[model samples]
Target: MPYMGDPTVSIILPTYNRLAYLREAAASVFVQTYDDWEMIIADDGSSEETRAYLRAIADPRVTVLWLSHTGIPSIARNKAIGRARGRYLAFLDSDDQWRPAKLAVQLDALRVSPDCRWSYTAVDLIDADGHPVDRDGLAPWVPYAGDITERLLWIHAHIAIDAVIAERRLVLEAGGFDERQRFGEDYDLYIRLAMRSPVKVVDAPLAVVRAGNGENYSANRIEAYEGWVQLYQKHSATLPGKRLRAIARSRRAENLLILARLYTNAGQSWAALRTLLLGIPGSLLTYPPWAWRAAKEVVRACFKATQRRI
Candidate 1:
């Protein structure tokens, strides 16, 4: 094992079956203007293609490790961190790629602000095909502060793990990533990190996130929001009073609305109706368009129940 004592960063790229995308993502990493870095590609149980592709990379900075299939991203990420040997740990999803300047600029930001333990850059939302996304999905949270501790509780406005770079010690002290969470693990990790210290942001966007895949995690909004609600419940003890209670109420509505859809998907319309009703007021106030849609579903379910009686 070569001691990369002077390397600036270790980027963890986790892949399951994305051989072609992983190849492109790897190329992007090698092309970075900032030369001193290590890229560890943690390959979860993948097809023979990806297993073979991992063997073909020539870069000395790149190291590929294989593990059996595990659906939990947090676990795979934690495994990668265990293998990391950099002063700073950056994350780049297998399907995503970064601009050449990403490491250089983000390092400058982290260097200038010694008090901030973690920093992230903005990112471009692209399609599954790697084409630029027209929709401004993550742009809403732009120009946010270097110190963003309290603001992280409400919602996960930061979507790109590629944008984030955390000090290795800080990443370990923050407990790294949660291994148990099936959904919204990134959100939970960010909240915990923010609570301990400030999360800084670079205004410039340096990475591109693949979007528009119907199978993407965010597609199941209900489960993700429910997980968010649980995250708050689990961590509320460490937070302030009103903020804690309000987050529960706020996240509860989001969870219920998602649960309503989940119930509907499971063909439990009545259960869905109950959840929609319980979730409405809060959702109406917080998630207007989505809550509005849930309200319509509630009315539809009520009429369907009346018809069943007839």
Candidate 2:
């Protein structure tokens, strides 16, 4: 369907060299049940094949912005966002696809809740081969609505970037994605947005996310944990209320403990010890539970080291 006027939603899709997945991702948007939408594909210096594929798109509703390789998704996404011509904005990763009614359902939810400018839906996890996979060890795939600021602050609410449809102005007011953050940038944006307004939810799973892909940054355990710690600390200083600040601190401490364990498993005992020491102050300041958990992890690491020495 050709839309003459400005679209209701502008889908910001950032892509790199994943031409095959990008093809499928774009195709999903083309088949959406809702028609008043435009898709902006931001290319992050992909190979000629991917560029050629993007150029071949005949749909006028779809626009492609070519940019030099920055290797930072936030930069590419922000560029696409700058060119978006819609009241609402949605995101679809190059590796993810959406169900046919995704836009229709999310738009309906937003219409019903006039005050809610942002919405997210549950997502199904799929492997690189497009086969359904179990979400083991991942946060629960559930729908959360209304003021989710506290849940987001505590890292309890999991909102996938691909599963969101937010107002364009709200996204801009939230400062877009934090360009400095390489990992967990989406989480950072969601937290800021939730703090600004109530969120609506589409209870059904509409987005299909590709998990366990080697290209995923979250696969790097140590770096991902470090990114989480940085994210928590960044928000801790700005988020209102002493209780919220404490929650942020405690969450940061948890990530630090996890990072220490990762370092210990990699046989970097000194780094692990340093990480544990760094988390101590925050853990002590917030409450006892996290401090106790930190101490237990320290003892376990020491025990493992002693066994290796013996």
lDDT of 1 by residue, 1-90 (tens): 554465779889888887777888888898899989988888888899888888987778888888888866787889889988889999
lDDT of 2 by residue, 62-165 (tens): 99999999988999999999999999999999999999999999999899899999999988989989999987777675577898988887667788899999
User: What TM-score quantifies how close candidate 2 is to the native fold?
Assistant: 0.91
* Residue pairs with backbone overlap in model 1: 222-258
**Candidate 2: worst-modelled 10 consecutive residues by lDDT:** 135-144
Give me the candidate number with maximum TM-score: 2
How accurate locally, in lDDT, is each candidate?
0.76, 0.89
RMSD for all candidates, in order, please.
4.0, 2.4
Q: Could you tally the backbone clashes for each prediction?
A: 1, 0
Worst lDDT run of 10 residues, candidate 1, spans: 135-144
The residue ranges of model 2 lying beyond 4 angstroms of the native Cα positions read 1-3, 135-140, 289-310
The number of clashing residue pairs in model 1 is 1
